[model samples]
Target: MSSSPEKFSKNAVIVNELGLHARSAAKIAEIARTAKSKIWVIRDGEKADAASIIDMLALACSKGTRVTISADYSEDIEILNRIKALIQNGFGE
Candidate 1:
């Protein structure tokens, strides 16, 4: 068994028209819950749990905002990548 968990981190821009609002935050949280990793999003030096809609909304991210995401898990990297793509694609708007 591994002694330490694998980690993933990346920066993504909020390109959606509405930014990181309640609905968008819900979408992010929905996807985040599928992974075993603990995911966190950082904006302007403030960090929020990606699995929590309220935490995400508290970041107050607007369109064109840049955010950093970090995940720690023992599973494949697909989860983190998927989240990155979702943010990059503006969560399909």
Candidate 2:
């Protein structure tokens, strides 16, 4: 079987009111890890490993800041959708 790789993206929200705080970072981190594909977050031209919760929180995603989330993978549209939903849903905090 052949699996084609594709990318899906959306801006991560700065919804914590106090910005992307620990709780919000943790949520994004959790979702990123759950996916089979690699997720990367880039800010100010700098990139961080999305799977590490600590790294994410360190970005200090302030309130109203936008982070681009890109995913690359195959045979996992469902996972992609979930990730998208989590971002769209603002991590359900």
Candidate 3:
């Protein structure tokens, strides 16, 4: 029997003045796309595909919004951390 892969996640707050807008979402998606497993961004009970810019934008996360960045597999932990850092750093805005 095979067991599910370990999941990795981190929490971060949107610190950018503009929040998670198109550019920031795009940046996240870019990193997410490199993950070997699925990446998810969740906010206020709403989940968005980290690889989908539109899905992220739909979350409408504004400044100070808290979000969870998760990876379906432990192998993608670096991807999770990169995204978390990006959000925590205000997307470098």
Q: Pick the candidate with the highest TM-score.
A: 3
What is the TM-score of candidate 1?
0.85
After best superposition, candidate 3 residue 34: deviation in angstroms?
A: 0.4
Cα lDDT computed for each candidate against the true fold:
0.81, 0.65, 0.88
Ranking by TM-score: 3, 1, 2
Kindly provide the TM-score of model 2 when superposed on the true structure, using C-alpha atoms: 0.70
Give the TM-score of each candidate: 0.85, 0.70, 0.91
C-alpha RMSD of each candidate structure in angstroms: 3.3, 4.0, 2.7
Prediction 1 global C-alpha lDDT:
0.81
Candidate 3, residues 8-92, lDDT tens digits: the string is: 7788999999989999999999999999988989997788999999999999999999988877778888888899888888888
* Tens-digit per-residue lDDT, 1-93, candidate 2: 123222455555555466666776677677778877677666665666677767777787786677776666653455556655765566676
Top-scoring candidate (lDDT): 3
- Across 1-93, the per-residue lDDT of candidate 1 in tens digits comes to 233332467788999989989988888788889878677888988889899999999999999999987777646367677878998888887
In candidate 3, list every pair of residues with a backbone clash.
Answer: none
Off by over 4 Å in 3: 1-7
Q: Single out the weakest 10-residue window by summed lDDT for candidate 1.
A: 1-10
